[model samples]
Target: MKFLSAAALAAGLCLGLGATQAQAAQKALLIGAGEYPYLPPKAQLSGPANDVRAMTQFLEGYWGFSKSDIRILVDGDASKQKILNAIQSWLPGATQPGDRVIIYYSGHGSQIPDTSGDEEDGKDETFVPTDFGRNGDQASDMLSDDEIGRALNMLKGREVILIADSCHSGTINRDIVPGLAKDGIDARPRYLPFSGSSTFFADARDVEPLAREVDTHLNLSAALPHQLAWETNGSGIFTQTLIQGLSSGQADQNGNGRITTAELLNFMRPKTEAWCQGVEQCRELQFTPNVSPRNEAFVLQPVRPAEPVQTVTGDSSEDVSDVLPERERDKIAVRILPGAMHEIGDEVQFQLTSELDGYLTLLDLTAEGKLVLLFPTDEDRAAGKTGKIRANSTLTVPDPSYGFSFVAEAPAGNGKLLAIVTQDRVDLEDLLAANGTFEPIDDKMGFIKEISGRLNTVWTGDTTNRSVSWAAGYKEYEIRP
Candidate 1:
C-alpha cells in the first residue's frame, strides 16, 4: 500500500512542474472609435474600430492571451472615465515578475493645454470621442496624457506597454480652407448638424513647440466653427501599420516567429510614413516606454545583433563658424545655407548648451521644402550618451545641458539644417551659436531627403539590417556618392 501511494504522489508532482513551465506574462487593453455624427463623416468604415478589433484577435489567438485576458473599449461610448476604469481593473495581482501588460488605442487623439509641468508642452494627449468638444468650451469632456500616464503609473507592474494611436499636437493634420465658409449656398454646408445654442469655435492657434505644424479640418461632424483646425489624428494610421508589422512576418526579423518592441517600431515607422505622405498627415510618431522592467527573465532570449558597416570616406578639412543665437526673432538660432558645397560623407560638428529642458530638433528639407529629417530630443541618442546626428549632409548637436558636436556619417550631397531652441532655452541657444556654424556638404536638397531617410530609417530592436524599416516619410534614393 505504501509503494502504490508513493508512485501516485510522484506522478501528481511531475504534472504540477510541467504546468508551471507553460505560464507567461500577457495582458492587453484595446480601444477604438467609428461612430461620429459630425466631422469627416466619422470614417464610415471606422478604420480605428476595425483596427483595434483585429489587434485583439491577434493578441488572443497568436500571442497566447486568452479572450478574457483582454479588455476592449470602443467608440465615443469609450469615454475617459470608462477607459480609466477598465485599465484599473486589468492590473495583475500577485503574479510572477515576468508578466507584461499592453495598452492600445485607435481613434481620434488630440492634445489639451496642460497647465501642469509634467508634460513638455504643458499639453496632455487625449482621445477624441464622438462627443469631444471640437470647440474648447466644455471643460469636463477632454482627457489628458498626464492623466493617463498617472493611471499607468498606479499599476503595480513595472512592465506596462503603451501603444498610443492618438495624434500629438501638430504631428497629424487635416487642413480647412478659409473660403469654405463664404462660398454661397453650398459654401457654408455644415458637415454635421450642430445645435447653434452654443457658438462652437475651435481655438485657432498653432500647435506648440513642434518642428512642423499642420492645421486640421475638424468639426462635430464637419461644420462647426466654419472650418477650423483641431489637434487630432484619424485612427487608421496606427491600426494598419501596427497590423502589417505584426501579421506579415516583417516584424519577425530573426525568423523566431515572435515579435519584440524593437521589431514593432522598425516595422511600423516606414509603413506609417507611406500611409500619410501628403493628405491628412502625422509628422512625428512617438514610441515611449511607460515602465521599465528590471532584472526580469524573458521567455524569448535576447540576441545581440551586428552593427552596420561604416562606409568609409576620406576626411576633408571642415570649416568652423561661430553659431550665434540671434535674439532678434524669438531668440531662435536659424541655420544659414552655406554658399559652397562639397561631396557626401563629410563631417561637421556643433558646440551647444541649454538652460531649460527643451528639445534640440533638426530638420532636413527636401527640394520641394518637405521635411525629411526629424531627430528630436532623447530619441536622437541613447540616454546619457551624446554625439552627432547625420541629417543628409548636415550634422546637428541636439543636446540640452552641455556644448557638443556631431560628425556626418550617412552620405548625401547637400541640404539645409534648421535648428530651433525654445524661447525659454535662450542661454543654450546663444552658447551653441557662439561656438559653431554648420558646414555645407551638397548643392541641392534633392538627395538630402534620401540621405536623411537612410540615416534615420532604423528599426530599433531588430538584429537583421536588411529587414530594418525607414523613417516617417520613407524615400527611395539613387545618389552616386
Candidate 2:
C-alpha cells in the first residue's frame, strides 16, 4: 500500500541533499502525553511516555543528535499551547533553513469536524495533548493536520519527518460520542468506544504548500484509519520497530550498507502487521499500517557491526528478510540450529516458532541451488501436518510422521532452508506432485522473487490472488563431501 506523492518525492530529494549539506544541524521535538488531565482515568496511556524516552535515547546515541538539540514534552508538561510553541515558534527560531528536523507524536488520537471544508469526510485528524479541553474549548487543545501543516510551513526549507503514532491517522473519519469510558481502546486494537469526544472549531489556521525542500510530510503512519497502534512492555510497537531498524541495521534491504526510507517502510509494514496479529490483545481487529508515497528516498546508512549482505544471500546468522525486500514480519520466526557443518546423507533439523496460530510452508535449497518443497508432501496432510501450527508451540522438522526426512544429498557445499509463515495454507499440489526438487534456479537472487512473484500464490495478501498475511524467514546450513 505504499504510493508516491509530492511530499515523498521531496523527502527523497532530501536524502540526495544529505551528500552536499552534511553540515545541516539535526534537531527533534518529541511529544507524548500519556496522562490527559481532563479525560477520565481510563483514558491514560503507558506507551507515549515510554515512546518519548526511547526516542530520546535513539536520537542521542544512534542518530547522533546532541542532548541539547532534542526537546521533550511528556505528561504534565505537554500542554496544547506548549506543543504549538515548541513546533511553530521554538523550532523555527532555533533551527536554520536547511536543518534536518524530526517531529514525533505517540499518544491518543481523535477526530474533529473539518470546519475548514478541506476534508471530504468532514473530519480532521488530531493528536491529544496532556491539557486537552483545559483552555475553554477542546478544539483549541486538539492538534489538527492542517494546524500541524501550517506550523511546518514556518520551517521554510527544512527537511522534515514526522512520525505519528496514534489512531485515526490514515484518513480520520470516526466521530466520537459520549459513552462508557474504555481502557486502551486505541492501545487494545478496538474501535473508538464513543467515549472520546471532541467538537470542531473554525479557528484552524490555513496551510500553504510544503516548502520545495520538504518542510512538512510523512511517508507513513503507525496505524491506519480503523487500525490502532498498540504497545507492549510500555513501548509503542511502531516506535520500537523503528528504533530496531535504525540500531540493528535489519532494515538495510539492499545490503549496500544503506537503509533507504523506502527500505525502512518495506521492513516495518509487515513486522508491524505480524506483531498485531500475534499479540492476543490485538489480534481480533487490526490491519496493515497505512503507507504514503515517497517518490524520492533518503538513505539511513547508520554505522553498525561489520555484517553486510545483499538481498537473499547472507551469513548463517542472516534470515530471509536480509535478502527479500518486502514481507518481513515479527510474528513468526525461523532458525537454523547450531549453524554447523554436515556431511552427505546427514539429516537437517529446524526449529520454527510462531507467536500466533498460523500455517507453515517449508522450502529447501540444495548446494546445487535446486529448490524443493519440504512440507505438505504428497505424504502427510492430516494430523496437523501442513495444518495449523499452534501458537507458542515449536515444530521440529524431519519428524518421522512427515514421511520424508531432510537427508542431505550430493553436490556437497553450502545450502539454505527457508521457513515461511502464512495466515492460510498455500496449496502447492503442482510442486508436491513433481516428486522431486525444481530445476536449479537460473539466478540466486531471483529465487525469492520467483517464489513470491510467480511460483507462490498464497504467500501475500494482495488483491490479485493472496488473501492472507505472510512473513519471510530462513536458515543456512552446510554439507561436505
Candidate 3:
C-alpha cells in the first residue's frame, strides 16, 4: 500500500492559501500495507492496494491536489519508527489553528497496552505497521492512538481526521494471547481491577483478548462496538460508505458545493455500524474534529436520473412502430399558486422539490425506462450538483423560491407519467402540523366534500381534496400524468 507525505500537501496548501491564512490544509496520508511475505499470508492484500490507488487518484484528480503536493509511502517490511517518521514528515506543517487535516489508514489495526499507564481501560488503540511485533519489549514498533493524537495535536490547528480501516480486537480473545500469539475468541471478558499485565484501561482487554481495539480507542470506547469494526477491501465499511457519500454528494446534505471533514464523519459513523445489532459486536468510527465544526451537510442534485438496469438477451433492434406523436390535444396550464405546491413537473416540466437536500432525477416511465434530467434548461447547475430540482438554500422554508421545468412530446394514448425524487421522503403530516393547508376541489374549482380511490376530476388547484393538494410544504413532490 502507498501513503502520501504531508510535505507535499503543505506545498499545495501554501499555494491555495493565497490571501487565506495558512491555518488549515486539506491533507491526507493514505497508508495501505498488509504484513505481506513476512507475516502469514492473510486475506489477499490485493483489496487494500487497489483501494489505496483508487483513493490516490480521487485525491489528485477530482480533489485537485497536484501530484507533487502529495506523498506516497508503502511499507512491506517498514518499521514503526519509519512509519511515524514518515507521518511526521508527510504534510509537514499541514495544520494551523483552525485548519483541517485528514489521515486515512488502510491496513491491520489493533489495540495494545497503553504503556503510558494513563488509560483506565489499560489499553490504547494502535495501528499496526508493516513490522508490528508480538513481543512486550517491542515498544518502538507499536503506534498508539494517543501517541498519534499527541503528535497531530502538536500542529497549530486543533481539528484532525484519522481514518483507520482496521477492526479493533478486544482483548477477550480466548484464541490468541496478546503477549503470546493466539487468535479467535468470543464473549467479553469480566470487568476487573487493572492488572500489571493490563496496559491502559481496566476493561481494555475485557472486550476481547486480541479483539480489535476499536472499543476503547479515540474516546469512542464508551460506545463499544460502534467504536471499532472490521475494515474490508482495505477500507473500513464506514470509510467506503463515506467515500461514496462524498461522491454521491450525500454528505453535503445542505447542498453546499464542498464536503467538509465533519460532513463525511457525521454521515459515515452511524451508517458504518448500523448492521451490528449487539453492543458487543457493534463498532464505530471516531472523529476528533477539534477547532471549527465541519458541516458536511451539503446537498447534491443529480446530474441525470439514475439509469435503470436492463438485461439484453438478443438483438438490439426491436420496436419502432409505437413512436408517434399525439394528434388530439387536451391542454391544461398546470400552475400551483405561489407557495401552493412548492414544485411541479410532468412530460413538459419535471420539476422536483425537497425539504431535505438531495438530487432530482427523472426516469422515463414511458416504457423505455430511460434516465433523463428532470429540470428545464433555464437553471444553472453548480459543481458536484445533481438532481432535476432543488432548493436555493437549506435555511429557507417551503416558500417556493426554487423550482425547475422540463418539456417532452408525449406519445398518443392513455400513457401514465411516473417519476421519483432522490431524497428521503418527508412527512406530510409534519408539514401540516405547522399550519399547512390542504383542501379538496370540485370541477368548478370549488371545495369538494371528500376524496378517495379515483376522482372524475378536472382542474383541481391549491384548494382541493385532490391527491395533488397534499403537496403543500416540507415534502418532495412527484407528478404523475
Candidate 4:
C-alpha cells in the first residue's frame, strides 16, 4: 500500500508554476466569436465555443489559474469593446512582472485595407468581433494587427504568450488557404471576408509588436498572412491541438520536467501537421505556425521530478508466508534492454522476474508523465496467457507472439518502468486510458486517487493477518531528442 504512493507521484507530475502563484500567477484573456450579426450565416463559425471552453477548463483545472483571473469573452460577449477592455484593462491590471500572460483569440480573421502603412503587404490582418462591421463601423468593429500590436505593447517586458488561432491577413493565402469545405467533412476556415459593404475605412495606426527578448515573449500565429486558420468538429484545429499538447505534457520535450518555448514550437508543428493528415483530414491544407525569436527560450511549464523512492525487497529464497511482512516476502526483478536513455522511434523491451507466484502487473510512467499498463495488454489476454508469474520464472513483455513492441515517442523526459507482484488481480479497466495501448489521462490527480483507492480495496484488513501482499519495484530512465 505504501509503495503505491510512489507510483501516484510518478503519474502526478504537478507543476510548481501552477500551484504557488499567489501574487505573480498566470492571467489570461480568452476571446471567441462564433456568430457574427453583420455577416451571412455561412460566415457563422462553430469553433470558438469549443476553443474558449477547452482553454478555460485547462487553465483553471490543470494549470491552476484562478477562474477570476481568466476573463472569458465568448460569442455575444466577444465584441470589440469587451476584448479590448480585457486585453487593455483586465489583463494588464492583474499581471505582475514574473507572471505569465496569455492572450488567445479564436474566430474570423480577414484583411482590411492597410490604414497602417507598416504592413509590408499593404493589408492589415484583423480578427472580427461578433458584431463586426455592424452599423457600417468596420473601424471600431475589427481587431487589426496594428490594434493588436498596440494592445500587446502595454504588456511589454513580461512573460507573454500570444496565440491567434484566427488567421491574419488575406482571403487568398499561399500557405494554408480556405476554400470550399472538403467532401463529407465539415471543416471550416476561421476567416471572414468583407461581405457586400464596399466602403472599407479604418483609422491609421502604427504596426509594432511586443519588442522583447525571445525568452519573455513567444508569439504563435496559426497561419501566416493571406492564409486561412482551419477548424472542424466544432473546434479550432490550432486551438484544440495546442491545448492537447500543453495539457498532455507532450510539449515537455526531453522529459526534463519542464516545457521550454522551443519545445512548444517543435511539439506543436509536427503534431498539428500529423493531425491534419489523420482521419477526416483537415482540408488537406498545409498547416504551419509562424513563431518568432528563433533562438532564445524559456520554461513554459515547471513540473517536478519524482524523488527517489524505496521499494520493498526480499531474497529469492524467502517463502511467501503469513509470518513474514509483505515487504520482506518477495524481491521484484525488472530490467530494460538497449539502455535507459533512448531517442524517438527506438524499440524497447522489459524483463520481469518475481520471487513469488502471483498476478504480475507491469506499468510504464511515460516521459510525458502518463501511466500505462505495459503488461496484460489485450494481446496478452487474447493469447491465453494469465497475469500470474511463478517464482524464479522470467516474463518478457510483448512476447513477440502478442504482436506489439514498445517504441519510444516524443515529449522526451524522465520515464519509469514499474513491476508489481500482487496477491490478487487488480482491476484497472476504469483507470485504463484505452484498449491495447493507453491514452494519457487529462486529470492525473483523479487518476492517482483512483489507483490508490483501488489498491486499498484490494489489500484490505489488518497487515499481520492479511493474506494479501504486494511488492513493487521501478526503474527510472530518461529520453532525449
Candidate 5:
C-alpha cells in the first residue's frame, strides 16, 4: 500500500511539470508578402520575404522560440484566409494563459472606406494579401485592422506582440509630388473601396488604434502618417534596423543585458529614420516607427549576464579641433545664424566663410536622425553657383534667391549642421543625383557610410598632400515647439 501511494505521488508531480512546460511554451507567426499577383508589377516588392526570414532567425536565436513552434507564411503562401485563420483560430487556440505569442507582418498596407464605422478616421487600415484584387472583392481579400483587433481580443489571456512594417497611405505629404522624373516610381500604397469598386486614396495615418487591441504592438512605418514607405535592395530599412538592434545588443539601452518590447521599438525608431534619410542609395522618404504598449512591459529576450564596461578618459581642456592640423583648421569657419532659441516654423540658416577658394557642402542631422542636404542647391549649380568663396566672404545659405528654406517641426530636440569645405571640387554626383529632382533619397546607409568615411579621412591628419584640402565645422541647436 505504501509503495502504491509513493508511485501515485510521483505521477502527480510529473503531470504538474508537464502542464507547466506547456503553459510556458512560446509561439510565433510570421507573415510577409512581397509579390502581389493581382497588382501591377510596380506594386511587387522584394522586402517582405527577407523581413520574415530575418525576424524568424531573431526569434529562434535570441527569443528561444523553437523552430517547429514558429510558423511562417510568405509571398505566395500568405493569403487573406490563411492569415485570418492563423490569427483568429490557430494562435489563440494553441496559446494559453502565461504563454507568449508574436505575430509579425511585412508587406504593403492599404486603406479602404470604413463600413463598420469602427475607425475614428473613417478609413479602415489593411494589410495587402497575396490575392488582393485590384478592382473588387476587397472585403474578402484584404485583412482589415478591425479583423486583426477581433483576432487579438481572443488572445487576451496571453502575452501578445504585434509588429507591422507597412503603411496605409501616401497622404503624409500630399503637397509633395512622389517619384523621380515624374515616373511615379514612388507609388503610394494600394487603395481599395470598402465595398464593390471605387477610387481610393493612398494617404498615411496613425497605427496606434489597431495597436491598442494587442498587449503590445510596434509599427515600422516607411514614412510618417500619410507618407509613402520606401523599399531598397529588396529589404525594408525598418526591418534591417530591427534585426540589427536585436542581434547587435544595441537595443539593450539600460545595459540590463536584456531587450524589452519598449527598448526594441525605441532603438529601431531613430535608426529606421536615419537609414531611410541618410543613405544616398536609399530613396529619400520619411520613416517613423511607432509603438503602443500596455501598462506592463514585456521582456522580448531573456536576460543574460551584463558585459564588462570599459571607460576611457580624455583631457577636458583640450579642444576637439586641436586634433586637426593647424593649417586645415584656419582655412574655414562656419556658424549658425539667429543664435537664439528658434520655434517651429522658423527658418534656420547656416553661414559659411572661407579663407581660400573651395567647394562647400552642408548637411543637417535632425533630432529625429534624418539627414538633409542643405547646400549646393540645383538652382545654385545651374546658375553657376561655384563653391569658390572669395577669401573673407560670408555666404548666407538658402540665399532667399534660391526660394528654399528649412523649417523646424515636431520631434523638437537638439539638431546639428555640418559644413564641409574642400579646396577641390568634390564629386558629389552620386550623393546629389536626385537633388532638386523631387526624387526621395534612396540609399541612406550609403550616404552615411560615405560621408562618415570622408569626414574621418579629412579630419584625421594634414591634407596638404591631397588634392582636396578640407575642413568641417558643426553647430548644435535646439528646435522648440
Candidate 6:
C-alpha cells in the first residue's frame, strides 16, 4: 500500500499557477510500479515511483491540475484491480466532455502470446502490474494494449495523452565482458512465463482505433517498439526530459507562448538522444521517443512569450569554388528520382545515377532518427559485389528481386536518404566493428561521427586521384490507418 507520501503530495498540490476562467477539470492518473512482489527481486526497479512523483508535480504546477484531480499509484498499490478500476471506472467516469485527461505509466512492460490473433506480429504488448505472476496464467493479470484502448474508448474527454516510459520487451544482458557471472536483472520490464525470448512488437494500429475516438490523442513512448527504454539514478530519461521541457518552457519551439504536442516531441527527441549518449550504460542503447498524435495538434502548456530577435541574412548564392581547393567541388554527380512524399505501404524505388564511375553507398535516416545502411548490406558484402556504378550508369536500389524498398512505418515523420559516391572502394568492416556488428547504429550522433571519420580517413590527405561526393533526398509522408 506504499504510495506517494502525504507530505510530498501536499508539496505538489501547493505549487500552482495563476488561475484562469472556470474550465473543464484536468485529471491525471499517474501509475508507477517499481516493485513486483510476485516476480524475482532482480526485476524490481527504483525509478518508476520517482517518475510518477515528478510528473505529478509537473501536472499540478504548470498544467493546472488540482491535487484532488490527480491520482498517484506506486509500487505495491498499483495492483491489477486497482489499475483497471482507475482507468476503466475512475478516469472515464470522473471526466466530462472537453476535459483533459493524462494517463502516465512508468513501469516494466512485456509481451505475451496474442491469443486473439489480432496482432500481425503474433504478440501483444502489455504492462506489467505489481502482482504480475511468473506462472503461465499471469497473462490474465497483465494489462494488454487492447484493454487500455477499450478503457480509453469509454473516456468522455476530448484531450487524452498516454505516456509510457517503459519498454515492451524482456530482459537484455548489457554486460560487456565475456564468460563473466551475470546478474539476471534486465534493464527493461519483466517478461511473463520467464521465457528466454525477448522479442516483442508494438504496433500503433492496436490503439489507433480507440485514439481516433478522441479529439486529440497523443501517445509518447520512451523508446521505439523493439528497443529498450533505459533508466538511471531513479527516473526514466524521457520522463526527466519531459518534466524539464514543460517546466523550463524549452519545448515551446514556435515561441508562440505555448507548447504543442508536436513541438514537445521535436524538443525532447534530440535531448533524450544526447542525454542517453552521455550515460555510460545507455551509450549503445538507442532511445527514440515515439510520438503518435491522432487527429489535430493539441497544446500541452503555455509559457511566457519569447523575446524578439533581429533578422540577418547572407547572400542568397555564394560560389564555394573560390573557397574550395578545386578538388572539393564536384567530381562525381549523383541524383535520386521521385523526390516527394509517399504512401506508407507503397514500394519506394530509389534510382541513383552517377556521372562518373565509382562505388556507391546508400544510407537512410528514418523518421524515428534511426540510421540504417541501405546499400552494401552484409549479404552484399559477403557476395563481393562492390557498390560500383559505371560512368553515367543507373543503379536501382533493392534490385526489385531482393525485396528491398523503403516502406514507411507508423508514427509518421520525415526520412532522409544519402547517396555517397566514392572514387575508391569503401570498406565497412571498421564501421561495423565500431557499431558492434549492428547494421543500423543506435545513436544518431555516433553514426554521424563515425561516418564522418570514415569519410575523412578515406577521402582526405590524398584526393588528387580519388574524389568523393554525396547527395541527399528527403521524404515526408503520413501513415494512414
Which whole-number lDDT from 0 to 100 does residue 477 have in model 2? 60
Measured by TM-score, the strongest candidate is 4
TM-scores for every predicted model: 0.42, 0.52, 0.43, 0.52, 0.51, 0.51
Residues 349-428, candidate 2: write the lDDT tens digits. Answer: 56788865676767665544345556545455544466467777988765656555555566566655566665555443
**Residue-by-residue lDDT tens digits, candidate 4, 23-142:** 245678888898878766777888898899998887876666667768888988999878887877787788644456888888887766667576554566677889886777465468
Prediction 3 global C-alpha lDDT: 0.35
lDDT of 4 at 440: 47
- Each model's lDDT comes to 0.37, 0.57, 0.35, 0.60, 0.57, 0.56
The candidate that wins on lDDT is 4
C-alpha RMSD between model 4 and the true structure: 20.3
* Least accurate 10 contiguous residues by lDDT in model 4: 13-22
In candidate 2, position 279 carries an lDDT of 56
> How close is each model in CA RMSD to the real structure?
22.1, 18.0, 19.6, 20.3, 25.7, 22.9
- Location of the lowest summed lDDT over 10 successive residues in candidate 1: 1-10
Q: Candidate 1 lDDT, tens digit per residue, 148-236?
A: 65565444322445554543333322332111212221111101222222423234323221111111000011101112121113334
- Alpha-carbon runs more than 4 Å astray in model 5: 1-23, 134-139, 170-207, 213-224, 278-285, 294-298, 302-481
- Model 3 residue 99 CA deviation (Å) reads 5.1
Predicted structure 4, TM vs. truth: 0.52
Q: Give one digit per residue, the lDDT tens place, for model 3 in 429-456.
A: 2212222111111121111101110111
Give the C-alpha miss distance for residue 17 in model 5, angstroms: 16
lDDT of 6 by residue, 321-392 (tens): 122222323444333334445444555556676655677766654444356666766656655666778867
Q: Return the number of clashes found in candidate 6.
A: 0
Worst 10 residues of 5 by lDDT: 1-10
